[model samples]
Target: MELPRHYNENRLVLMVQEPTIIFSYWELSRGQWESLGDERFLVLRLYTTGSNRVSTVLKEVSLPPFTNDWYFRNVLPEHTYHAELGYYGPEGEFYPLLRSNKVVTPRTRPVEGMVRFLKVKTVILDTTNKDTAEEQGDSNAFWGGYSSMDLVHRS
Candidate 1:
């Protein structure tokens, strides 16, 4: 069996690992990889959402041969970013191969009470235990440690 002469390998993906970190992955078809010839070097370009309005390049990275993935650090938090994978020619030109989806890094610090609410853990205790007085008090008790008096005032 013989493989097809041309394969559809145009794909680029971006992921956020942390507030200051991002990851990129790409694939190149056999033809696209070989067309570069001696200029087989690859590069990754980053663009901020704000800059995307004007189609600007925030940063550029030179990728090694056969490299299909990269980890970028020191990126700002709470900002949307995108990456472009391309080939670098000797004439100081970059031929774009694929563009990745936009990824937004999470904020480094959450607002007040936000962290507390997110950290709150809820546990469902078996309220059917007839031996416990607490369970006997309220069968419709919520997951939180809510007393009968608290429930009365809430209603």
Candidate 2:
């Protein structure tokens, strides 16, 4: 008995190995490989969870003859990401052939009492209006010169 030349399903499969590592596998039939006709490159694109707009090419592996597996490492944690299998070409061009399902990396909790700093900025409000004083001597902009209590009441 001999094995089949290719499986029925030609698809890309991705899995998470660790908080910062991913593994991928794919299968391409002889007909599909011939269609590419050399200059075949497999590119993996990573996207931030829930956002199609935010993404970057994580890795690109040149397909030589019959290679179809890759291990992606050093990924960010607590983010949803997906892999795109595609062909790479001239002038930074890539055409995606297939896409894997989204995979979310595991989250690690931070230690208790983590050191965090809060920044406070100081702002000064000039109660003395030089422009009003110069223009109108003693005329105020509001009935009581726009007090903070007025702002609070308006809100």
Candidate 3:
């Protein structure tokens, strides 16, 4: 499937491999960003173990005044702000999607370590459709639907 026009620009692509979801944050030059409409947006890609479909949860987070080490050492409460792109199986049951503990660490020079943390989750969907399985098999295809998580804290 072709990616949405909005995602066709100079954007980061997250690929869900096994055990870890790898994030490739693009370093768009001025010209590159301008050519792509220059929208300051983040893109996330998720892969699952093909079990059950789940609803995407979006959360906004805040950290107390603490050193970086302190922040990483404790679990913090997160405030959920938005959730969209809910998934349903053939039975039409609602499943819950969660953020995995593996965080993406930014590697770019200027933004290196700028991102405090990232949480990647495998959306489990409950279904038995063979067509869905086929669609997922095409590695070149892009799934339009995505889960969005805006922030990450200790907890």
Q: Which candidate achieves the best lDDT against the true structure?
A: 1
Listing every candidate in turn, what is its Cα RMSD in Å to the true structure after a full C-alpha superposition?
A: 10.2, 17.1, 21.9
Better of 2 and 3 by TM-score: 2
lDDT of 2 by residue, 1-155 (tens): 99975694568888999988888888866677678777666665655554566666555666555567778788887878777777767877888877888888888776464343343333333566444432444333334334445556779
**Model 3: residues with Cα > 4 Å off, grouped in runs:** 1-23, 38-40, 49-155
What candidate 2 gets wrong by more than 4 Å, as runs, is 1-5, 50-53, 63-65, 110-155
- What are the lDDT scores of the predictions, listed in order? 0.76, 0.69, 0.30
lDDT of 3 at 85: 18
Candidate 1 local lDDT, 3-22, one digit each (tens): 86445587889999999999
Q: What is the per-residue lDDT of model 3 for residues 47-145, given as tens digits with 9 covering 90 to 100?
A: 222124443333222212221111121111221111111123447553322223323332323533444333333333336543543355645333443
Ranking by lDDT: 1, 2, 3
**Candidate 1 residue spans exceeding 4 A from truth:** 1-8, 113-155
Instruction: Return the TM-score for each candidate structure.
Output: 0.62, 0.57, 0.18
Measured with C-alpha atoms, the lDDT of residue 139 in candidate 2 is 38
Q: Measure candidate 2: CA RMSD.
A: 17.1
